[model samples]
Target: MYVTEYPKGDVDKEIDKLNKKLSRSFSKDATQVIRKLQKANCDALGIGRHLIAFYPNTWKEKDKNEYLRNVKFKTNVDVEIVQVGIAE
Candidate 1:
């Protein structure tokens, strides 16, 4: 996933738009994949071993934090901030 904003229009608006997209892209289908695997697991589901690589955009510090927080707090997955911005 990539979060980015060019130097045009309103940055906040762009960030908000990106946030909305981010929230929707990684959906319940992802969870389902894990669930199916767990159904066959002999022991622990061990979803915590999986990494949900999250790379949300830059500040709107509050919004960015909230987005990442929701992903981390709401899910059993461990998310890693792999990168910020599209490039550089």
Candidate 2:
């Protein structure tokens, strides 16, 4: 349910906006999980993969950091509260 924009503006600004959007969309627990996931440098959202897949020739020749530094991300989360169980 996430939507990302490649705005015609500064990359850092875009990333900052994206971070704020994602943080607001997720719960505190979910935010912590995302931070942990990011700690491993895992682009679970497939952004890096998409770039590599669509731009293979260019990707092969370019520095990954250069590409990643300019990349922006936005994430949305839907959490369903499945059960409110009795305390055991």
Candidate 3:
């Protein structure tokens, strides 16, 4: 995600730290949601459709009803803070 922050602080070090924290927070939140969906066997992201389209052989080997439960998802969120004003 692109985060444009007009931070009140002028310290570059502090801003970088804040950016890292924000990134981690976002990543954690997203991962939790994915885990919940996986546990419920809910393929809300249409992953199965993509698999059928791109990986037909791999898709055919899995049980259609249990595919979501068997899938492992790793979520990564990258946040870039675009500083607008003058900061070093």
The candidate scoring highest on TM-score is: 3
What lDDT score is found at residue 9 in candidate 1?
57
Per-candidate clash tally: 0, 0, 0
State the lDDT of candidate 2 residue by residue for 13-68, as single tens digits. Answer: 45555556655668566656656656665667676688688978877876665445
Candidate 3 structure quality by residue, lDDT tens digits, 49-84:
999999999999989998988777788787666654
List model 1 lDDT by residue over 5-85, tens digit each. Answer: 456555445665655555555555556654555455421433232322232223323342233223322333323333346
On a 0 to 1 TM-score scale, where does candidate 2 land against the true structure? Answer: 0.39
Worst ten in a row by lDDT for model 1: 47-56
Best candidate according to lDDT: 3
- Model 1 ranges with Cα > 4 A deviation: 1-12, 42-84
State the lDDT at 85 in candidate 2.
Answer: 27
Query: What is each predicted model's overall lDDT from 0 to 1?
Result: 0.42, 0.56, 0.79
TM-score-better candidate, 1 vs 2: 2
Q: Candidate 3 at 26: error in angstroms?
A: 0.8
Candidate 2 yields a Cα-based lDDT of 0.56
